[model samples]
Target chain A: MIPVITAFDRSPDGGKGLARDTRVRWALEEAGQSCDVRPVSFASLRQPAHLALNPFGQIPTYEEDDLVLFETGAIVLHIAERHNGLLPVDAAARARAIAWMFAALNTVEPPILERQTAVLLESDKPWTAERLRSIDQRIDVRLGQLSARLGDDEWLDGGFSAGDLMMVSVLLRLGSSGLLDKHPGLAAYLARGEARPAYRRAFEAQRTFNTRPGPSE
Target chain B: MIPVITAFDRSPDGGKGLARDTRVRWALEEAGQSCDVRPVSFASLRQPAHLALNPFGQIPTYEEDDLVLFETGAIVLHIAERHNGLLPVDAAARARAIAWMFAALNTVEPPILERQTAVLLESDKPWTAERLRSIDQRIDVRLGQLSARLGDDEWLDGGFSAGDLMMVSVLLRLGSSGLLDKHPGLAAYLARGEARPAYRRAFEAQRTFNTRPGPSE
Candidate 1:
């Protein structure tokens, strides 16, 4: 059965492919899975229906038949585990791949998100600039560790897996921050992920939908 | 084959069970799996050997024969998938359980971690008090959402799964923060997790190790 996933009715990014839905879309495209999209406005996100689907009330919730799953990482992982392309067949290799997913969401992304919080939410605070510097330094430490691990290697492990997908998506958030410019290999790595045919399709789909005119009465 | 997991030689918590290893220990105990522990000092975690096992240089690395995995969420998940107790047998139920794991680490923990950053890393700054209030409010929003979803339920979903294991572990960090006291339901929920026999055993083991004297010559 085809899955249905919820996304922003009008993305805050205006179709930069930065929204979480793009990650789910990319995963489905990689898995050769065709899924339906349901647009949810910011106001409706807090409504009872969205809350039932996702307690966090965030976009990119996946519904397949009787199952409803939120958290983009989990949704992408679900598709990866069920399908072949996103994860390796080997047991050990598969666990390693999943490790990267957690690393992305937990270790790597936290500092990045902090930077965003500082910019978007705390920009009015007097200490915002100093806080941003600290956050950036923390991010740099993670990126350095990651760059070391990924040095001269194409993928994190044996081949491209869900690990790389999540990592690339997380790193893409830094595209505007210019941190990626400091690490040539990581920059190239992100580029490679964007170059994937599946990624292109996912990007275009979210972009088209996000940039479209508001719903008609 | 028995698995071996790595942890801090001396946890910053000094036996409080705040170290990431407790989560892995809890999962192993829950699964009735006996795994060896290899403690790594802070100085050694960044060294080549530990870095090879975990590129991020964090503790709680799981090594079983040829497979080496890190990230507490991934480690608990690996243990859960291999053993019968931590995940539901049904596919959809299993997916939902995994989503909670992501939610715990990604959504719930970030704000908590941010609060920690403010208290531990930036307390000396001039803006600490004002900044902490903002962080606390962000955490409150998440706690409110989680409490609403967990009202009168034993677990996040149908029954206790790895999701609860992870969510409880994440909440444990907030025990000293006083924020948990504001939400009675979540406080009780966390109490339930701590009350588990498996959790108690894991906590005791980590405490024993963390409080032990210097490594044997």
Candidate 2:
């Protein structure tokens, strides 16, 4: 059964991959799987209909056959696991790849999200500058560490697994912040991920959704 | 081979399970395994010795005979994958459980971490309150969605798995915020997770470490 997932009718980022749905779309495109996107309004998301598929009432809940799944990472991972392209055959390499995936979301992405939060919610706050510095520093520290490890390496672990997909998606958030430019390797690394045909496909798909006109009057 | 992970010499929370190490400890405890704690000072965490194990210079990196893993979610998932208790035998259920793990870290924890950043680094700023509200509202929305889904359900999915362990750990961050109390089900749900014997053991172990004295002169 073809899985259907939800996305914002219009993303705040002008359809940049910052939206979580982009990750799922990227994964589906990577796996060579075609799926349907169900655009949801903020109000409708809270309704019982949407809530049932995703208890968290978030975007990108996967419904395939009798199975329903939420969480973009999980959905991406599910796609990676079920299909052959997203993970390597080696057991150890696969585990390491999965580790990188967790690191991307759990470790690297937190500070980036904080930066966005500061910009979106606290720009007028008195402590905004200090908070921004701290957030930027934390992000730099993580980037420096990751850069050292990556050290000219292509992907985080073995070849481009779902881990790379997620990591690149995450690093893309730093585009507006300019913090990523400070780390040359990471900057180049993200460009490489974006250059992927699948990524371009996924980006275009979500962009199309975001730019599309709303329902008829 | 037994895995030895690091813990804070004195957890900032004074033994509260907020310490990331608690998650790793919980995983080990639930797996019916015994592990060692190599407590590290904040300075040591930055030193080359500890940095070799975890590039991010964070706590709760797992070290077995040959493999070393960082990121609590990754380490916990690794432990669960190798051991029997934390993952389900059914493939689909297992996928769902793993998804929850991703959901907990990637989806749920990000906003909470953002709130923490605002409180810790931006509290002195003029826009602190505004930023905090925006961040908190984001978290609140997520929590509301989660609360509704967890309504009466004991755990996120079937019998307690790594997913619940992660979900509960993420929810515990809201303790001081009082946001959880607003949703009785999630609050009680968090309590159910804390009430687990394994969770209690993990909490106490971190507490003991945090309360213990440092290597004296």
Candidate 3:
């Protein structure tokens, strides 16, 4: 049976597929799976029903027949583990791939989110510029390390796996910030991830969801 | 052969077991695995040898013969997957447990880390107090949601798993800030986690390592 996942009624990213749901979508698409989407408004997200599925009241909560889960990393890992495409078959390689998944979400994404917080929440603060600078510096350090690691490699490990999918998703947040351009290799890397047919479909699906006209429009 | 994991030469936590290594160590103890700890100084962490092991040049890197891994979440998950104690035998329960692990690291810990950044990096800023207040409120939102979810529960789910282990570890970061106290249920929950024999062993091991006299001392 197909699983269902929650997404934002209106993504803050507008038409861009930067929402967490897009990660799960990309994973599903990569795995040749079809699923259902349930969109929840900001208010409905905090409601008891949605909270039952996701205690955090966040989007992209996955619900199968008997099992329900939240956290995009976990959901993606679940899909990848159950299916065949997103993880390597080798025991050690798979562990390394999973490690990169955690690195993408836990290590790499933190400072990027901090930069977003600085830009979105603290722009009016006097320290905004300095905060952005510091956040960017931190991001650059990771990018430099990542670039060194990725040097001429197609994927983080062997071939494209969930690790690349997650790293590319996290790196995409830096697109508008113009940080990707600073490292041409990473820019090319992100481009490769986006070029995947699965990613393209996922991006388009989220775009349609975001751009659909409503009474407010 | 015993595995080797890196730790801070002189932990900033001063043996209180707040560093990320403690999480891995706790997982190892829970699994009844004997491993070697290699302490890496801050300067040495960025050196070529360490960078080769961990591209991000951070501590708590796991080296098991042919495999090298980083990220505390990944390391802990690795130990749990290899050992029987930290994960349930049922697949669905395991999935749920892993979701909590991701939720702890990605969702819950981000704001806590933000608070840490504010305290350590931006404490002298003119807006420090107000910024800290904002950060704390964000943390409180997650804690409130977590408290509601964890009401009257001994562990996060059916039993003690890696999920609870990670959640308790992440919540420990908020100890000095007194944020966990606001949610008495969650605080009690954390106390129960600390009461585990595995946690005690891991904490004592890290404490001994951290408190060991330096050459200069």
Instruction: Note the Cα lDDT for every prediction shown.
Output: 0.92, 0.85, 0.93
lDDT string, candidate 2, B1-217, tens digits: 6788988766778888798999999988999998999877787888889878888888988888777788898888888999988999998899889988987887788888878866886677677776667777888888887887776889988899999999999998887897776788888898899999999898888888777775611
Error of 1 at B27 (Å): 0.2
DockQ per model, Cα? 0.92, 0.67, 0.88
C-alpha RMSD in Å of predicted model 1 compared with the true structure: 1.3
lDDT of 2: 0.85
Model 3 regions more than 4 Å off: none
- lDDT per residue (tens digit) for residues B1-217 in model 1: 7999998888887899998999999999999999899989888988999999888899999989988899999999999999989999999999999999999999999999998888899989999998899899989999999999999998889889999999999999997789988899999999999999999999999999888886631
Question: Lowest summed-lDDT stretch of 10 residues in model 3 chain A?
Answer: A208-217
Best by lDDT: 3
Worst 10 residues of 1 chain B by lDDT: B208-217
Q: Relative to the unseen true structure, what is the C-alpha lDDT of residue B9 in candidate 1, on a scale of 0 to 100?
A: 85
Estimate how well candidate 3 is docked, as a DockQ score. 0.88
The stretch of ten residues in a row with the least summed lDDT in candidate 1 chain A is A208-217
Q: What is the TM-score of candidate 3?
A: 0.98
> Where does model 1 exceed 4 Å of error?
B215-217
